[model samples]
Target: MEKYINAFTDSLLNTLDYTWRAMTFDVPWYTNFFWGLTAISLLVWLLEIAFPWRKDQSIFRKDFWLDTFYMYFNFFIFAIVISGVYEILGVLFNDLGITAKSFAIIDIASWPMWAQLLVFFIIIDFVQWFTHVLLHRYEFLWQFHKVHHSVKEMGFAAHLRYHWMENIFYKPLKTFGVMILGGFEPEQAYVVHFIAISIGHLNHSNIKITWGPLKYIFNNPVMHLYHHVKALPDGHRHGINFGISLSLWDYIFKTNYVPEDSGTIELGFPGDEEFPKTFWSQITYGFVKPKKKQPSN
Candidate 1:
């Protein structure tokens, strides 16, 4: 108990310091997640302004400001909030005699930098893709995920407009992926992080990109737009196009779907009009049981 408390204190302070340096540009440029996210967002927003796939969508799209706040909240504020908990978890796992390297299936530490990054990216992307499918497959998870699907207008900022619970789900699985790769994160792993951010922003941006033949290899705006559609296909009750940074998983698993590229299809899920609009309401949105239909009177 004392150890956990100390871990919490130490992680909280370290997280604060890291966030400050990131914001003040004191960290190396490649590892400066704060500024890196900002730069990518700005660049994508500029692209959306110059060449919008949905020409009618506003520069200030619905929930644009809200989503912008979400980007920072999830990236920085939420990190501060969860740092202690994560540290405690690490301590607990260590006490349990389990370490990341315990699950090591391969040690790519000695692999070429490019190869290490490629394997890391592919494994992490698949993990995220699977987790995304689970988010839709389960009702309890979907309730939280509704915050993201609540988007009525798509844009670059929408990429990060998800419930914080998703971080709880994703981060652990991502760590497990690293564990599988012999718990060896390469020195240049930031490259994978930056590329994932760029692809994710582009995936949700209001800019058309199919990547031509590479559409099969990577997620793009067109394919991901369909992921937010109000209606699912006949058999896809959960969702479709579950890919994150990579579309290959969807194509391989037969979850990919894009009947047309009209770019005017309605976004949002059924009854999204009733979803919460405020940040506080949204972050806490999906934690309770719904009233049982009163036995249909």
Candidate 2:
């Protein structure tokens, strides 16, 4: 009996030790990423209920569990996938007669930490903006990006919903852009993404606040929802409002839209079509070739 009791006690202590490490460890970006997301999401959820765009929408809306799965999968597994791809590309660059050392970006660490942070934020946001535009302009890329827009009932977790292979299309350009400007330590980049993605969660969320004039500078729910609008607004036929965190890019490029009644529109693809409802299917969706249109007789 004592031996059995001791075994159980050891297991309990081991469990506690693991939990404490998870809560305390900061090496892997996901530890801080997960905790930061959790805390911000809780506050966002509370505000969502108190100042909701759609009062009828529940916290436990459709695909809630699936979105949670996406949040973890993208944050942990796919983040590692991105890192691996970045490394492989570095190897490829070396093979192509360009050595890794030759491509090294300036270590901008000599600048004030806050200045480095600001530069990274602006550059990363621009990279995101450019990558997002490409995803929409080409149907092949849209196959991956469309999974994100497939949500009928949007919420905080909706930001996390994405096709797994998106990094393949997005990361090379972004990494190159960052490298050209100045390569940051992993920690600096993480802080920038943490803010950028947090804003994304809030925009996708059901919370409806205009943020007054700040709407022109930063993306808000009204502007982002219009981005998800099935049809084009006013001028262009292809989708508009592709900005990630900053709306300035969209404004300068003439893709910005602010429908007077953003609350009334249905979000998702044209004709309100469906996407793969399952996580695995969504990840595999980009692999399926789109049908070519027949030539007119």
Candidate 3:
């Protein structure tokens, strides 16, 4: 009977290992990328149609196409460039023996495929929430990050309108650090990457999900929208949700805020309202001049 039980366990382990290997590489980046972009874009447009953040329909005009182009450009071109840099940095760290030794507490890879994904999502989100809060509170880093907040509208494309410097300094570093510390295999890290990018697009989307209690679990569109609010005088804009996947960290750290009476609080930097609408202007302005100081109460 003991021999039979051992055989059953061995077979299950083999099956799980095979399944994880298959699923990890089975990810068709082209198909997933197109579908993810299409789905998120459609949701954003639908929200605009339904809620109409601004009565002036012109807000979503030809200029929107320009902004959309810049968005996709950054997502594909700039993303690739920064990721290449990250790979180089990872290699350097490995050579210097700076990474954590293999000591993962849970071997989720031996579990069911879905379980592995859940673990990855939860862990990555926890790391991101803390890193995000640090970036906001630290004045030096906020200079580069403020560009993201300069967006006057919250749409799906708004997610990609980040300075490449911010991505270089944050996502790659934090992700690489977590992978090294967790001793996650390359395949496991890949799955986390796909999931993170997909959810990031979703979080910045215009889709209206009530989320209810689930808001505590997943960082939904509404929660993220608050994070985009430009700083104000009476108090900081009632937008502080910073977690990309889960809101647990934000809640734990006292950074989560959702006002019951607020509705589409004015989005964009304090002085960005007068900035040129051109893409070049936005990019240059973000880096050239120092960020306008937040008004003191």
**Which numbered prediction scores highest in lDDT against the true structure?**
1
**What order do you get sorting by TM-score, best first?**
1, 2, 3
**Candidate 2 lDDT, 69-118, residue by residue in tens:** 89877866666445534555565666677652354566666788777788
Model 1 misplaced stretches (Cα beyond 4 Å):
288-297
After TM-score superposition, the amount by which residue 238's alpha carbon in candidate 2 deviates from its true location, in angstroms, is: 1.9
Better of 2 and 3 by lDDT: 2
lDDT of all predictions: 0.93, 0.74, 0.62
lDDT of 3 at 9: 57
Off by over 4 Å in 3: 1-35, 43-63, 99-107, 185-198, 231-239, 274-277, 284-287, 290-297
* Superposed Cα deviation of residue 149, candidate 1 (Å): 0.4
Q: Where is model 3 poorest over a 10-residue stretch in terms of lDDT?
A: 14-23
What is the alpha-carbon lDDT of model 1 when measured against the actual structure? 0.93
Q: Write the per-residue lDDT of candidate 1 for residues 1-297, one digit (tens) a residue.
A: 899999999999999999999898899998999999999999999999999888888999988999999999999999998999999999999999999899999999989999999999999999999999999999988998999999999999999999999999999999999999998888999999999999999999999999999999999999999999998889998999999999999999999999999899989998877677799888988775443335555
Model 2, residue 7: distance off in Å is 39
TM per candidate comes to 0.96, 0.81, 0.71
Kindly report which residue stretches of model 2 are placed more than 4 angstroms away from their true locations once superposed: 1-31, 95-107, 185-187, 271-274, 289-297
In the predicted model 1, the residue pairs found to clash are none
